[model samples]
Target: MKQPTLPFWQVWNVSFGFLGVQLGFALQNANVSRVLSDLGADLHSLSLFWLAAPVMGLLVQPIVGAASDRTWNRLGRRKPFILGGAIAAALGMFLMPNASIFVAFLAPMIFGGMMLALMDGAFNVTMQPFRALVSDMVPNEQRTLGYSIQALLINIGAVIGSILPFVFTNVIGLDNTAPKGEVAQTVTWAFYVGGTALLGTVLWTCFRTKEYSPDDYNRYKNIAPKIVEKLSLTTKLANFWKLFINMPKTMRQLALVQFFSWFSLFIMWVYTGPAITQYIWGVEAKWFDAEFLHSVDVIPADIAAAKGAAGDWVGITFAAYSLFAAIFSVFIARIANRFGRKITYSLSLLAGGIGYISFMLFQNAEVVHVNLLLTEIDIPQGALNLLLPMVGVGIAWAAILAMPYAILSGSLPADKTGVYMGIFNFTIAAPQIVSGLVAGQILKYAFDNQAIYIIALAGVSMILGAIAVYFVQDNSDSTPDERAIQGH
Candidate 1:
C-alpha cells in the first residue's frame, strides 16, 4: 500500500519540533565556547572540551534509533524518544551555562562540559528519530519538500537562538559580562528561553502529529516478518557493524563529502570564538586558561571585556548566517527543481567557501566603509566580513540539512529507516570527532596559534565537499521499492 502523502500543514506540524530543537542546538552552537571561556577554558583545550557533543552524538543516535524502531506504546513509535530527548535537552540547556551556579562543587568548565555532552546526546536522540519520521511518513516524491520544511524550520530556530545573546545585550540591556568565573546574564537568559522553546515545540509536535503503528508500518513497507523476534543489545551492536560493512555505494560516496563538510564546520565552531577575540578585538583571551592566567601578567578586566565582545560578535555572525539560511530556504525548492539537487548543492557550498575565504582579507582594526544609497557607513571589517560569507553558509546549510537525507530516504528499507538514519549520523559525528581531536594540535603547531587560519581551512574543506557531491548518484527520483533493492 502506498503511504498517504501529508499536506503541507501536516508536514509542518510534524517537523515544527525541529524549530525549537534547533533553537536549543543553535544557542549551544553559537555560545558554548563563550560560556566555557567565561568559565575559564583555554583556547588550545577548547576543541577538547567540545569533544563532548560529537562523542555523545556518536553513541546516542544509533541506540535511540534502534530503540525507536522496536518501540510501540500508547505514545507512538518515535514520539517517546522525541519527547524524552527534548526533556533532557531542556534540562541540559538550563544547566549548561549556569553550571557554575547550579553545580558549584565541580569546576565551572567541567560542569559545563558535562552538560554540553548531555544536551548534545539528547539532541541526537531527538534528531535521528525526526529524520527517520519524515522518511516514514512522506512518500518518496515529497521527501525533498518534507526535508526542506525541516531545513527551513531549523534555520528559523537558529536565527532566533543565535541572535538572542546579541539582542539581550544590546536591545534588552542585559549584562553580557559577569564576575571572574560566572556566565553572563545574557547567556543565562538565552539558555532559559531556549530551553523553554525546545520543550514547548517538541510537545506541540508530539500532540499534533501521529505515527503509523509498528505492524502497520511494516505492512505499508511491504515487509512481512514471520517472527517478531526481540533484538538483544549484543545483537544490535553486531548489526550496527554489519550495516557499516554493507553500507550502500551512495552512502559511501556521500560519506567522503560529509567528512570534509563537517570537519570544516567543526573547525569553525571550535575556533571562531578565540579567533574573534584575538584577531578582531586585539586582546589575548588567555586569562581563562589557568596556566596562562597564572604565568602571564594581565588585568582581569581587560580579559573579560575582550571575551564579551567576541561572544557578542560571534552571536551576530551566527545570526546573520541563520537569517540568510532562512531567507534562502524560501526559494531553495524552486531552485532545486530548476537545477538538479547536486548542482544546486555544489554551487551553494562553493559560495560559502568563497565567503569564508573573504574573512582573511580584513586587517585587524580595519574599518569597512560601505556606500549604500548615498549613505556612508563604517562597519568593523572583521564583523562585516562575516556577514557576506554567512549568505553562502546559509545556502549551503539549508541544502546540507535536506539534500543528503532526501536522497538516502528512498534507498533505505522502510522498517529499518530509523536505524539507517541513526547510522547515517555516523558520518556527521565521525568528522566532528576527528576534527575535535586534531584541531587544537593543528592550531598550536601549524597555524602558529592563530584561530583565523582554521576558518581558512574550513573554507577549503567546503570547496572540496562541493566537488565531492557530483560523484554521488542521486536516488531522489526513484521509488523506495525500486531504489531499495537497487542500492543493495
Candidate 2:
C-alpha cells in the first residue's frame, strides 16, 4: 500500500488543537497547587483534591476512544468529539475558580476535572489517528522529523501556558489578593483566558486541519468500522471487560512499568511546591509573622511592586527546559531509532531519577545571609537555583511524551489502534490514582509528612522503570500483514 502524502504544514495544522489541549494541561499542572491551597485545603489534602482528575480519566478515556472508533461527521469522526470536549473544557475552566468551601469546592473541581477528562478523551480520539497520519504521511525514514515536530509544538504550548499567570498578576496588574481566602481576580482572569484560548485554538485545528476519511484510511487495510450498537451501562462494562481480558501480551507486561513511572510523577507534581516551601524555604516563618507571606505560586509574591526581572527569570527557567525538549526530541527519536525504544527509555528514566535525587543534596535548612550561615535569617523562595532540576524533569518529560508510544504503536495490531491507545493512557492515569492515595499516606507515616522524600522514591521508581524497559521485547517485524494472516 502506498502511503498518503502529507505536507509539513498540514501536520502542524492537525496538531493545532494541541495548542488548546496543552494550554489546559499546563494551566492545570502549574496552577492546581495554588488553587487548592488558596481554597483552605491543607497540603496533605491537595492530593485528594487532585484525585478527581485521574478518576475521571480512568472512567472516560477508554469509552471515548471506543465510541470515536465508530463515529463519523462532515468534519471528521475525531473532530466532532474534539469540538465537544473543547466546549466542555471551556465551560469548566470558567467555573473552576468559583468554589465556596471544602466539600463544595470539590464539586466544581471534580466537575471541572470531568470536563478536562472529556476534553482529554476527545483529544485522544484524534491523537492516535493523528499519529497514524504521521505514520501514513511520513516515510519510515522521516518519522523522526514527524515526531520531533509534534514534540516542538507540545513544548511551545506548554511554555506559553506556564507563563500566563506571571503575566497576569505581575505584569497585567490584575488583583492577586482576595479577602478571607477567596480566589484571586487574577486567577479568575487566568481561567477566563484559558477557557477562551482552549476553545479558540481547538477551533483553529478543526477548521485548519484535515484528516483521512474512511476511504483514504481503508487503502492500507480493509478496515471496517467496529460500531458499538449497544449503549447501556451493562453493555459498556461487558465490552470493556472483554477488551481488558484480551489485551495484547506486550501491553500486559508494559503496564507495570507505566503504573510505577506515573505514580512517582503524580507524587512529585502534587507535593513538590509545598515540600519546597515548608521543608526547604520554611516560608511559614515569614508568613506566620503576618509581616511577609508571599503569594507567588513558585515564590513569594512581592507586594510593593510589580514583578521585577526575577519573575521573568522563573518563566525563563520553566520555558528553557521545554526548549531543551524541543531541541532534544529529535535527538531522542534518532537514538530510539538506532538503539531501540527500551534503551532510550532507560536513559531517560535515569536522567529523571538523578534529577529528582539532586534536590536532596540541596536540602539545606539554612541559606547564607550576610556571607554567613545565619540562624536568624531566611531567604526568598526563588533564591534556590532550579535550573538543573527543571532540565532533569525535561528529560523525563521527553521520555514520557515519546518512547512508550513508539514502542507500543510499532508492536500493536494496527486494527486495534483506538482500543490500545485508550489502554495506553491508563498507564498515565493509574499512577495519578496511586499517588493521590499513597503519597500523602506515606508522607504522614514514614517521613513525617516530608514530601521531598516522595521525590526520592519517584526517582528510584523511574530508575526501576528504566530497568523494566529491558523486559519489553520489540516485535516490530510483526506487521499488519502478518497479524491478519495469523487471525490476530
> Which model scores highest in TM-score?
1
TM-score of decoy 2? 0.81
Candidate 1 backbone overlaps, count: 0
TM-score of 1: 0.93
Q: List pairs with backbone clashes in candidate 1.
A: none
Q: Score every model by TM-score.
A: 0.93, 0.81
Score each candidate by Cα lDDT: 0.82, 0.63
What lDDT tens digits, residue by residue, belong to model 1 across residues 377-477? 45467666667778888887887887788667777777777887888888999999999999888888898778888888889999999999889887655
Worst 10 residues of 1 by lDDT: 370-379
**lDDT: which candidate is best?**
1
What are the runs in model 1 whose C-alpha is more than 4 Å off?
Answer: 102-104, 285-288, 295-302, 364-379, 478-488
By summed lDDT, which 10 consecutive residues of candidate 2 come out lowest? 303-312
lDDT of 2 at 49: 67
